[model samples]
Target: MDAVQVVAEPRRREILRLVWDEERSAGEIADRFDVTFGAVSQHLRVLRDAGLVTLRQDGKKRFYRADREALGPLAAYLQSMWADRLDTLAELSEAAERAERGEGTDT
Candidate 1:
């Protein structure tokens, strides 16, 4: 699956959040979840395949971290969507305030 599709799952997104800033081993990530280690492995596999994360090998350990540059498009899209939603929320809040103050009431 593509990066967008792969991250559509909340669990995978959570995994990304964990590795976003720092490199972590598979075992470290699995420890954060209540699910089985195998399940976490599968999620890690998906993230790796989707190019959303990078894997590095150090001795016997495999570390993972988010590929920030690879997430540019997705991040921009999400930010735009968030901005739009916030704009809508602000408009609604202002209208509600006006109603509360009886400044724009039709009644």
Candidate 2:
């Protein structure tokens, strides 16, 4: 699954956002959600399968956090697409400016 699919679920997205800054225990993360722990676990499984998160064992507890490397590709893809959109907007803006200056398409 891609990053988009991984983050498509609202609960999963919230989990990722919460864990983005620091590693969080399963219970700690689960507590923030209204759903049951089992439900949250299922969401984490999807995220882990998508390579968006990593789990580390600390004694008997598991700590989860966002995988920076996995998220990097997604970020790059979004940046590239946003840049193209910005370029299109810039071109439209320049055309509008020229039109305002009486250098429209008819001229």
Candidate 3:
């Protein structure tokens, strides 16, 4: 799945958020979820495929961390979408205010 798909899943996003600042071992992440370690591992695999997270082998443990650059596209996409919607909503609110004040014209 793509980054968008990966992040859309709440569980996967939680995992990403947990590891956003620091690397966490797979076991550590699994502990936060209600599911089993295997389930968390599947979520991690999806995030890995989307390039939103990377894994490293530290001795006998597997550590995962967020990949900021890999997530840049998702950030840009969300920002642009919010910007457009916010601009439209602001314009509508202003028009509503003008109509309420008898300043808006049918023409």
Candidate 4:
């Protein structure tokens, strides 16, 4: 699966966030959630398959870390797309606030 499709799963997204800045063992990653270690491992496998993470083996432990450089293209595209959407959301939210305040009423 592609990086975008792999990350579309919220659990996988959470896992990504956990290891974004540092490598963590499979057990460590599993501890962050209530799910089974196998479940987290599966997510890591998906991420690895998508080139979003790198796995290292160390004496019966598997460590996973975010492979951000590998996702440069997708990240750039997502940033551009979200920047516009986030700006629109902010504007709409501000408009709602103004309407809720009755157009600058002194109350």
Candidate 5:
């Protein structure tokens, strides 16, 4: 599957986020989510197949990390989208705090 299709799933996008900064073992990745190990494995497989992630095997464990170079333009797009969402979340949180302090209403 192409990178776009592979990352279309929410779980896959989150997996990418988890590995975006550094390499993580499959078990570590699985532990971050509430799903079964097999489910996380499937997502990893999809990411590996799409060349969106690089996998390394050591002894009995597999580690994964995002291949930002492979993602090319998509990486920038994802970063922009995530930034926008975070900005929106920050705005909403500030608004909630203001409301709690009774300072959000006009007049």
Candidate 6:
């Protein structure tokens, strides 16, 4: 699958984020999500097939890290997009808090 298609899934994007900075064991990555290990493993496989993540095997454990070089321009795009979303979410949360406190109501 192409990089864009591979990262279109939310879980795959999250998986990329998890391994962006450092290599992590498959089990470690799976622990962060609510889904079953099998699901996470499937995501890992997709990422591997897309060349977006590098895999390293040590003994019986598998480690994964994001291959930023493979992502190329998509890395910057994803970062910008995620940052914008986070900013919007934070604004919404703050507005909700103000509404709860009766501090920003127009009425």
Tell me the tens digit of each residue's lDDT in model 1 across 79-107. Answer: 56557878999999988999898787564
Task: Report every candidate's CA lDDT.
Answer: 0.86, 0.84, 0.86, 0.84, 0.93, 0.94
The digit string of per-residue lDDT tens for model 6 on 7-105 reads 999999999988998999999999999999999999999999989999999999999999999999999998888789899999999899998998965
Model 2 sits at a Cα RMSD from the real structure of 8.2
| Model with the higher TM-score, candidate 2 or 4 | 4
lDDT of 3 by residue, 1-107 (tens): 67787788889878977897799999999999999999999999888988888999989999999887999877666446557878999999989999999995576
Clashes of 4: 0
TM-score of each: 0.69, 0.66, 0.68, 0.68, 0.90, 0.84
- Per-residue lDDT tens digits for candidate 4, residues 22-67, read 9999999999999898898888899998889899999999999888
Question: What ordering of candidates by TM-score runs from best to worst?
Answer: 5, 6, 1, 4, 3, 2
Q: Judged by lDDT, which candidate is best?
A: 6
| lDDT measured at residue 35 in model 1 versus the true structure, 0 to 100 | 100
Worst 10 residues of 1 by lDDT: 74-83
| Candidate 2 displacement at residue 68 in angstroms | 2.2
Query: Across residues 8-94, which tens digit of lDDT does each residue of candidate 2 receive?
Result: 677886788778779999999999999999999999889898888899999999899988688876656644655787899999999
Candidate 5 per-residue lDDT, tens place, 28-95, comes to 99999999999999999999998999999999999999999999999998888888989999999988
Task: List candidate 4 stretches off by more than 4 Å.
Answer: 76-107
Task: Give the TM-score comparing model 4 with the true structure, all chains together.
Answer: 0.68
List the candidate numbers ranked by lDDT, top first. Answer: 6, 5, 1, 3, 2, 4
